[model samples]
Target: MTSVLALTAATAQADAFNRIASFPTHLNNAEANAESSAEIISATADGMTLVYSDSPLEVIGLIDITDPANPKAKGNIAVGGEPTAVSVIGNTAFVGVNTSESYTAPSGMIKAFDLATMTETAVCDLGGQPDSTAAAPDGSFIAVAIENERDEDLGDGRTGQLPGGFLVTVDVVDGSLDCDTVNVIDVTGIAEISPEDPEPEFVDINAAGEIVLTMQENNHMVVATKDGVINHFSAGQVDLENIDATDERGALVFTESQPNRLREPDAVQWIDDNHFAIANEGDMDGGSRGWTIFNKDGTEVYENGTGFEKAIIAAGHYPDKRSDSKGVEPEGMEFGIFNDTPMAFILAERSSIVGVYDLTDPSAPVLAQLLPSGVGPEGAVAIPGRNLFVTANEVDLIEDGGVRSHVMIYELTDAAASYPQLTSAGTDELIGWGAISGMSAGAGSTVYAVNDSFYGYQPTIFTIDTATTPATITDATVVTRGGHPAQKLDMEGVYFDGEGFWIASEGRTDRMIPHGLYHVDMDGNIDAEIPLPAELLAVERRFGFEGITRVGDTLWMAVQREWADDPENHVKLVAYNLETEQWGAVHYQKADPDTGWVGLSEIVAHGDYVYVIERDNQIGGAAVTKKIYRIAAADMVAAPLGDDLPVVSKEEVRDLIPDLTSLNGYVVDKIEGLAIMEDGTAWISTDNDGVDDSSGETYFWSPGKF
Candidate 1:
């Protein structure tokens, strides 16, 4: 008889052991999850899987589920696109790719291959981009989710945009039919829930072909038929009985709360046919905890426990879990057979471990064991034929210009057993050099990693390698890029088009200013540095440039204004086209001495618009508004030519720039960096400057139509 352990009792949190106990003094700079929807999930034979890539480019990884409690390292695959999800049927695996570069084509690629042989078969370019995908039950078709964005520029310098996400069915078997393979199924109503707009976090298709589960990440649940469009439903509104429930059909609806104060929703999972569970793990300060179990009809049958309420009862201590638990950010999850029974595989996202839990009882999940080898586990899948589970552990951080990642595999004796022993499937590392930030892989052992400097001052880049071992930097070498000493510059944000690396730089230290653009060649050589206007540079010196994004051949920058005594002074976004040498601006009202202008800071471009981050004045007793601004390229088409730029008094301009005041209802903080998304939204990061309520805060905003 298979061992039956009580899997629903909360594991005793015994003093909260540090997962990184060996690697003390590890860097712990936490940035908010700017793009939540693009988590790529792939599994290898070693039971390893790729979760979410931290960098701006593509990341692929693996996890070990052979022993659900002991997931270990395999390696990472660095592809050139913004990879969102992975699907495998038999030996052939399909990868979904996305691109966030504004100037580049909005294209996606599907890489199909024989995972068993590790051989490349075909590369299909999906002109219609995709975010995540699920394989059909019979393996004849694939349900791919694509997102189309619309920007609505608010005349007041702030713009808003909404996501129009849809699903496409792609044929996996016939590579020739891949060109005209997609069949569109609109998911706008299911995804567009918020007045501001809603983004789909993750979408999965069941093996039985009965239901497709799409986790919106922030809001409700979206359920669709195999060939039917997804029908949106709130987690609070899920009617379980309306559909047939099974690990194959109903197992995708699990919920886990965010561990941070940002209040993003938790990861979700499905327990069984009659029961589904949502983990309300709560955000920072142990905000909330409990499992909400619902029947087929969507009624809350019971809540087993609250956050620390249950943890305290089991182990004791006010549990402090952030959204991405440093131990594991709960993002990717899977429920499959274990030892002839169903088990839940949860990747403690960001955490280097895959958790095996007995979810037979939906109300309370018993922690079977914590697998300890994977890094950044996002998604996991179990293969019954081989009795193996695989996870993608994305580890794309460059400490000293080296890449370190592995595709780990784990083998299990029983596919339906709750927690069996996990064994390795031989780790395969995708070795290469340069600072890796993100990764993805294509057919024929093609691996990619987004490369960027750890310091905020390096050129954004992506490096390609085909090594079967984890990537690493063996020596400390001086590198030159973009006509500048790579060692001397500060840079962040990187993307990889199929041809070359698409990089962006925050440019400077100051907040309210504009910076120049620089491009790096494939051989790590700096080809050009498009300088900003001397006059603009002079004015920006008082402020500082933030985000530099590529939208096709043109680059966009958000120009945040400095503070002044008359709070009404404002901020602006400046767009510079690399192709046409044209520039434009989207201006916001200077804060009324009574109201604050809190100028825009970090700005990134997406498609046709630029999104800018706004921060309040740094000085206390000033405007308190904290918002992001969205500017369109159309409105900012005509810019002041640099050749005919005007000369200005630096001393006077600097003095006036600092004296600007802001309006009420806004916080006056030093808003710093920016990043753009493929879906036209923008991300902003602020500087603390040793101030209160101002450290480590990130914001997301989008541009509207011109």
Candidate 2:
């Protein structure tokens, strides 16, 4: 018994990196609805403090991570220019400040500040716009990539403009920068793509003091020492297959190919003294949609090809809107060795995920995990000594009432992975899924769910296995009409009735998506579509059926909000009889608005009650109502449509605020899915809004037996 107990305890403590906390960038600004950002990040030598560059706010922000699980905002420092990147070494912070007046007259400065006093100590004129800043492992020097980035509006955004960019190295002596020892290396006439304009994108230094850089727009890379450039080569091209190459189609079809696709690498990080990796976040021409490891002598050690993109797809993070340009857009990366395991973290900008790979074998890296990022992760830093990783998400959608820019902290601990709470990792075919709106429990551990209008062109029904950790999406079936992929559907609910599924679609008349219900067989063939009745359609104001479920011979639909004729704060729980083909509804008393309007998102029938999710549209701190309410099954009597409907009373089942905040993230707005099983266990989920102006975090968790 002792040995068995010891083994169980050992297994319970895992060796993985899990997110501990997130600090919003606007916290340091003291401004509400401020347009702030956290772009590139760095940390002090002890890893107790963090510094990030906020370009739009023109400041360098600081955070005290003395307690990694509870990061506190230290405040922001004015840099007097657009701070593009920052690197911290001991007590000094070397920041690359871009003061470029125009594309042709590009100029910037690399400034060093005392972290304690928060004052500028030394500065060096970079002679061009700087992109990435990195410090040598031994803290001997700092390297800045002088990008002098091109103006996309001018000359069709192609490179080869005048005043080519170069690399600058500043000596760091006694933990302080020495502006006099700054060495500039001319990196021109190297790459075959644009030899005249070599715009360096990212830089990294190894323990051996060798600095490596990537010229993204030029599709090139360079290796240099303090004295001069040693070797230069093309970032190279890849023939990508099985990729979704078309955008605005609202579907994930990986049948297209981009032949000889250029790998416009964006971020570079050294794995060791001999090898390094680059994130191919292409500009101008191409983005390989993955990462690559290369030897110091220009040999391709490992080419990710489409592997990383496919993994992102499996995690339900495929950004269909960016399919034509760069899918997911692998942009930032960091490498570290923790607990004898060498790992490389690659950031997917558009999908808002960090793909963690075990680089034990650089030539054959194993993708270990995909952690959810806040949104638009632009830069990252890995502190192996402290067993921590950090990401700076650059996009702040405050004006749009979206989540603010956040610097997420992940700590390597003896705890299991807590993110990606839902995935399609082991499915038969690669299934891209998101916007999980409504769900219904089936036999045993199976649950059926549907995607909303965000993927309107490809209506789909997903089968979920609740028995697995992260709740696996086992299969996906696209709803079809006459053997063609059904388009213009905003599927909000799905129900499995032993042999087939009942689907509810939430529509918008302006966008041409209809509000209706679908009877789909097991094979995804639509047997019939049930449109709203004349009276219901006349009163509809785009807030249509959000969920559907069955009881005896009746199909109950939860109208999202109050219609034109319904009383204030009362939504319709419409019912349809399969045998009688009649439409009726009962008024559901919803809560009054605290910040935004409250409405029902999902409905499920089981045992002796009918469950519904009532939530407010507000997110973060403004969110007030995100609850599960139940009404006795006997009270679900339906009155005829367009009449004075009887109101149904409800009792609160569970308060979902604590559940949504359990992940240590900002409270998401939509709580659209709820499913109760035979064992009385309940499952809840949220919609990610198709990752558009959203963090793209789909929370799927169980509230236990209800």
Candidate 3:
């Protein structure tokens, strides 16, 4: 069954996971700019606290989740090595730390710490690098995946390197980790590929004291108890059709194929004693781009195929840059039962989203919801007793001056799913969309939106029906030339006139994309193109027209940043008289940046006022200038382009930071789209940066009347 988030808000309200809070990992460190990550996460026995492996900080971070809606930073403790995975039994935390000197001679330790005191209690030498750890349900023992991972630079990056990996079982004596009772079980020579060097990726123990293991690089799987290996099988391969198999081309094309793609499972979780699920996040040779459920005997009970990736694409979270390697990259899996329903949480690593699958029928699981996540979700834990679920995002963009990693908390309640504030889930085809730059209120209860240059080859005008609760994209009209996808267009602004549209293209002369305007008919055929005048073109920078609005016979455009001739913290509101064919400008004073440069992103004229979205390049806690400002329509008087310009007075309409963080996510930087309808309702949206170096979250909402 090809279902991608088929549940609507009305149907999902019976029971659903809604995000309540986002805690930044850097908050645990004293330094504000410290780089940290929340990789593998586990909850305490009481489900009142959480612990996660932070590899970059060489520590394990702790959080007090007694109040799931307001998680507090319990601080991090130095483990003296790279913490790769963690699991909690009772009040003690078991952390797998990699102290490997090199890939040829792997060395690791299972470190135990008291969560209440944050002090080291014990350490067990594992003699190999550990990747994942799982605690038994009854607190009897713990399982660790000893992945003596191969060096990618060495040879073809295959798994058959020296010092093959194995499994370690540690007995929990008296409800605590007993390092002296550590036992090793050989897991080599069990699979068809790279049997000598079995790189165990993840492990999960069922109630029957059996461990389910996935050797990702070796393309193998195994089921073993403390005694020895019971069963083993190849992860096998899949034949995929209608997938985007090309990367870094700045487009979304899903007509390619990967035949016999290897299903290199990365993370596995036990659905029950007889069955388990694995996320097929491949290594070097393959990534099936989906998840699968398997019986203990290695028989496939269900395989999602391309259904999960299709849902991510529809939610505008598709990472086209990783398409050739893995589409959406399903890397983490969590199984939990909340309110008498078995649910599976599948995380898309590259897309930064979680696919909620209702496993009422393990053989025919249904895609129930898709929740937005922080960038690069690597681990997840479910506390069903408290009706809660959590995710540890591992990507920290400190070097890129972006948002830090975060641990997001979600609670199951009788309320609608708040994420995917906008979606194209029910579209006819796979309408892949992102980087929503501008919008215009269309006729009736509809809105017209446009994607920026991220999808350069697929310039589109999206028709959104606001009549729905979260709004829905009903149609996508591709702007074309001679019946083919247009070229050299960086559509940043769009205005839907009664009969057609006027689009603005931001210039990047370095990339051969010119700064200009286009007049198109309703059929998306370009009727005319208008280039910038010599006066404006000679003084242009990378920042150009961000939005456009029509007032009588004059069309006004908002420039993103100040040009050469503009004053400090002042940008031009360029205007073109359609009847006179003349160009002129008026100045709009913008805010002085507290951290980074601030500028305008959109402009919309409604009634007797003109609204604009002014924001800064900073994100998360560093954000300050995301707001809406308006100017009286009577104050917009344009002067000659080469002469002195008059500055228009503006009033602060609204502060958008509150609404931006309403969904319990890090504040995104781009507040690009704004639409004002005839009923005094104004809609606002943020750009997802085409899911590159971003959380792939687009916040679309209405501030009532801004």
Number of the top lDDT candidate: 3
Q: Please write out the lDDT profile of model 2 over residues 625-694, one tens digit for every residue.
A: 9998999999999999877899999999888887777667778899999988989988888999888877
List the global CA lDDT of all models. 0.40, 0.88, 0.90
TM-score of each: 0.42, 0.96, 0.97
RMSD of 1: 24.2
In Å, residue 297's CA in model 2 sits off its true spot by: 0.5
Model 2 pairs in collision? none
Q: Rank the candidates by lDDT, best first.
A: 3, 2, 1
What value does the lDDT take at residue 370 in candidate 1? 46
Ranking by TM-score: 3, 2, 1
In candidate 3, clashing pairs total 0
Candidate 1 on 1-706: residue-level lDDT in tens? 1111111111233211112111100111122222212234544433333232323434443333344434443334455676667776654567777764431234577666555444557666655566666676567777666643333234231112334445567676653125356666555544324424334444555444534444343345555664674345555421111111112110111233322222123444445544454443323222133334555345656543332122221111111222223112345566676656566665544334455666666656666544433334545555545455555445433332112232334555322222111111122421112222222222233322333333223233322222211122221112355355454343333333445443444445443223455555556566666666654555554443444455666555544564221123544445566676766544445344444335544444555555444555533333354444455545544436333222111110011112111100113245444443333222222332211112111111112111
lDDT of 3 by residue, 1-706 (tens): 1111222223344577888899999999988688999999999889999999999999999999999899999999999999999999988999999999999989999988999888988888998999999999988998999999889988877667888899999998875668778899998888888788889999999999999999998899999999989999998889999999998877788889999999999999999899999999998799999999999999999989999999899888999889899989999989999888899999999999999999989999999888889999999999999999999999999998898999999989887787787888887777888899999999888999999988888889999887776678888889998999888898888999988999988877788999998998898999889998999998999899999998889989999999999999999999999999899999999999998799999999999998888999999999999988999999988999889999999999888887777777888999999999889887777899999999999877766654
Which scores better on lDDT, 2 or 3? 3
RMSD (Cα, Å) for all candidates, in order, is: 24.2, 3.2, 3.2
The TM-score of predicted model 3 comes to: 0.97
